[model samples]
Target: SFMVRPFSLGLRLFVAMTAGHILLKVLAGFVVNAGSAGLGVGLLVGIPSFGLMVGISALELLVAGIQAYVFALLTSLYLNDAVNLH
Candidate 1:
């Protein structure tokens, strides 16, 4: 039972990450191409494009970090639950 929660969390994290990575890759390709545009063009396209890239990056970091922490904590909790070492 102790192992159940942690294992479930791990699987959830893996699935979430896979989806995030795929979406990030597709958006990154767009950002890179849009990013290469010149100053005038950049101002028109690059600024917003880069801004979105930054936003997404921050969000991804925050989300992934939270998920990782949750996983670790769940693992620790499960370990403690199993050991029964008050």
Candidate 2:
């Protein structure tokens, strides 16, 4: 139970950090692919995709901060447990 807690937290943080990056890359690919298709199609598809990427980028920034805070909080909690252990 004790070990699982930290492991799960780390796993969750890892997945959260990576998933955003992966989605951003996919969106960027869509923009690039659409641009090569044609000007009209490019404007239609690339604009929204690029906009989405921008929004995702901002969200990713926030997630990063939250992740850092969670990590520090967990680490402190773990240390406190270690110190108080019987």
Candidate 3:
């Protein structure tokens, strides 16, 4: 259980971070492709893609912080348990 808990936490964090990055990369590709498609299409697709990228970036930051906090809290709890073992 001890090893499984941290492993699951790490896997969740890894997936969250990787998914956000992959999404941003795909959105960036859309923006670049839209640019070559001309101004109208660029405005139509690029703007929304850019906006979504920004929003996702912000969300990624929040998720990273929250995950880090959770990881630290769990680590401390484990340490406490080991130290106070009777």
Candidate 4:
């Protein structure tokens, strides 16, 4: 039970963080590539991509804080379980 909990928790958090970063990179790439195209195309694509990137960046920051809190809470829960067992 102990091993399962930590392993699963870590894996889940890793996946979430990786996915978020990858999505951010992809969105940023779209904006950069669009800028290379032309003024009109760049205006159409770059604006939306930039806005989405900003929103996602904010979301990622919030998620990072929430993840830290969750990790700390779970650690405390595990410690409490261990102490109560003895």
Candidate 5:
């Protein structure tokens, strides 16, 4: 029950991590730009810049966790669907 499919889990985790990292960068850019101009978003200057990097890192970690959990859950669910019958 604790074992994960090596190749599948690896691939799933890789995909999640890559996608999450890219999304974080794109979203952070918006925050950075907004901080420079919009809504006197300049108010975000002091900490938002630092916050953006921290957010990206946090998101990557979240994605890693999600990938592991989702992959394992789905693998088990699939196995159950295929093998366990009422």
Candidate 6:
């Protein structure tokens, strides 16, 4: 149980980070495509897409920190559980 807990925790963090990065990449591609369409089209679609990417990037940064903290906290908690169990 103890070993499985940590494995699962790491897996969850990995999945979350991977998914966030993938979404960011997709959004970035949209921004690039929109910008290349033409000046007028670029201004309309690219501006909003770029803004959304900025917001998502900020959120991802926050999530990354939070995930680190959570992983550390969970590790400590698991350690505590192991110590107390014995």
**Candidate 2, which segments miss by more than 4 Å at Cα?**
none
TM-score of each candidate structure, all chains considered together: 0.63, 0.90, 0.84, 0.90, 0.46, 0.87
Candidate 3 ranges with C-alpha deviation above 4 Å: 82-86
- Tens-place lDDT per residue, model 5, 1-86, is 33445566667777877787777777677667766685656555535655766877887787778777888797787678657754
lDDT tens digits, residues 1-86, model 4? 86687887898799879999999999999999998999999999999999999999999999999999999899889878877975
Residue 27 lDDT, candidate 2, scale 0-100: 100
Q: Could you tell me the C-alpha RMSD of candidate 6 in Å?
A: 1.4
The C-alpha RMSD in Å for every predicted model, in order, reads: 3.7, 1.4, 1.8, 1.4, 6.7, 1.4
lDDT of 6 by residue, 3-64 (tens): 89988998999999998899889888888998789999888888888898899899999999
Give me the candidate number with maximum lDDT.
2
Candidate 1 yields a Cα-based lDDT of 0.76
List, residue by residue over 1-86, the lDDT tens digit for candidate 3.
66677677778889988999999999999999999999998999999999999999999899989988988998788778767875
**What is the RMSD of candidate 5?**
6.7
Candidate 2 residue pairs in clash (backbone atoms < 3 Å): none
The 10-residue segment of model 2 with minimum total lDDT is: 1-10
Collision pairs in model 1: none
- When sorted by lDDT, best at the front, the candidate numbers are 2, 4, 6, 3, 1, 5
**Model 4, residue 10: what's the lDDT?**
90
Please report, as a residue range, the 10-residue window in candidate 1 with the lowest summed lDDT.
41-50
What lDDT is obtained when candidate 3 is compared to the true structure? 0.89
Better structure of 1 and 3 per TM-score: 3
lDDT of each: 0.76, 0.92, 0.89, 0.91, 0.69, 0.91
Which pairs of residues collide in candidate 5? none
Q: Extract clashing residue pairs from model 6.
A: none
